[model samples]
Target: MPTIRPSGPADAAVLADIWRASVRATHDFLSEAHFTEIEALVADQYLPQAPLWVIEVDGSPAGFMGLSGAHVDALFIDPRRRAQGLGRSMIAHAARLEGKLTVDVNEQNPQAVGFYERMGFRQTGRSPQDDAGRPYPLLHMRQE
Candidate 1:
């Protein structure tokens, strides 16, 4: 059985590792530089207002999910633990929250887009780069 529990700052290192590995494995379509940037962002922001849930399988942390407001800011399952329903469970948990839940995924990440759709999210729109100059096509999906 897998258990989902709140993660604190203490879990940052392990969570960072999971985030890196998961992105590298599933996001091969992304550029190496983009991947590195994604990993760095997660490591730098995986605390405080963005709450995370560590997924433990048989007493060991195997994955994590992060939440911000009603959005699932991040969700990653250890590559080795893929296809075991952990992602679905985590998304379902997030969907149960109040208000519409939203997530922004890169346009190239079809698997993630499909996963979110299966979790009942519908494409809302697209967000281009903001004034900060960070560039990436953001596909917005929302569920109410």
Candidate 2:
């Protein structure tokens, strides 16, 4: 059975691993240095502070999403689990909680942009640099 549950301390390591694998597969725009830096933060800083939810298939972790209020701070699924509807499930879960969810998608990741569009999100704005002032651009989106 597939289930969504709140993450506990013990799930941190597995979630971090999934985050790394998911980023490696989808975020090709991240430079090596930036990837290393962000990975460190995700494991040490971001994961610890974020309100996280894990999705499991057959009681095994397949993906996670980090949320802060209505904002989707992060969403990642194990690469092996791609195209399995986990991401869409997470987004739908978020929508029910937030009423109208918001997220920032990397402009360079057309796959993600299209996925959000298909999920009923529309671009509301854009930033030339990501939150950390990295060169990577971000497209701000809100559910419409």
Candidate 3:
């Protein structure tokens, strides 16, 4: 079973690791160079500003999610733990905090889209590019 808890400074590195591992596994359309760039930004930039939660399995950090207002800013699970309900657990926890939740999923990543859809998020809109102006398209989803 997995447990969720508020994240602190000490969990930053673990969260970054999980983010990198998860992205590498599922974001096949992204280049290696992009991963390196994202890793740096997430570790030194994003994580410090977001209110994140860490998900642990057997006392080890397996994943994390960052919430900003009513939106899920980020969610990543260790590649090794994919499909084992860790991501679902993280989303469920986030929904508890923000009853109606929203998230932007990479359009290139069908698995993420499917997961969010299965979790009751409906496509509300889309963006031609990601927030960073990358070529990656984003599917805006909402669950109410």
Candidate 4:
């Protein structure tokens, strides 16, 4: 099993790479301008404030999860490492920290929604726009 550890300053660059690769792979609904804009914010602003934890696969960073209180702020895996259970491991680690977990999934990402459902999260609500007022719809979910 993979171990989850608190992120250090050194993990920032790789985490940003994972974020970019994962987002580009799954967030095709994002416009070029929107993607670029959010990328900068995540790399410079949001990531710095997030309580991040990294999962190493084969002695290197493979993915990470960001937490805010009991809510999942963000979770991303290297695009090449998807379907390898890295995401599941990250979520399990998050659950261990707080038995109850909440996350907002982009509605257009059915794969992510289904994965979370398989992991026992259920939809609690919906929003027409993301937290940042982006046009992407969001589906709120909770694991309890």
Task: Report residue 99 deviation for candidate 3 (angstroms).
Answer: 0.5
State the lDDT of candidate 3 residue by residue for 32-135, as single tens digits.
78778888899998887677889899999998888987899888889898889988888888888878899999999999999999999999999999999988
How many residue pairs in model 3 have overlapping backbones? 0
lDDT of 2 by residue, 18-116 (tens): 999999999999999999999999999877667798999989999999888889888899999989999999999988888889999999989889988
Q: Of the candidates shown, which would achieve the greatest lDDT relative to the real structure?
A: 2
Q: Of the candidates numbered 1 and 3, which has the greater lDDT value?
A: 3
Model 4: per-residue lDDT, tens digit, 1-144?
566788888888888999999999999899999999999999998776677999998778999998887898888999999999989998888888888899999999988999899889999999999988989999999996
Comparing 2 with 3 on TM-score, the higher-scoring candidate is 2
Local distance difference test values of all predictions, in order:
0.79, 0.91, 0.89, 0.89
TM-score of 3: 0.94
Better of 1 and 2 by lDDT: 2
C-alpha RMSD by candidate, in order: 2.3, 0.9, 1.2, 1.1
Per-candidate TM equals 0.85, 0.97, 0.94, 0.95
Give lDDT for model 1: 0.79
Q: Order candidates by lDDT, high to low.
A: 2, 4, 3, 1
Clashing pairs in 1: none
Alpha-carbon deviation at 129 in model 1, angstroms: 4.2
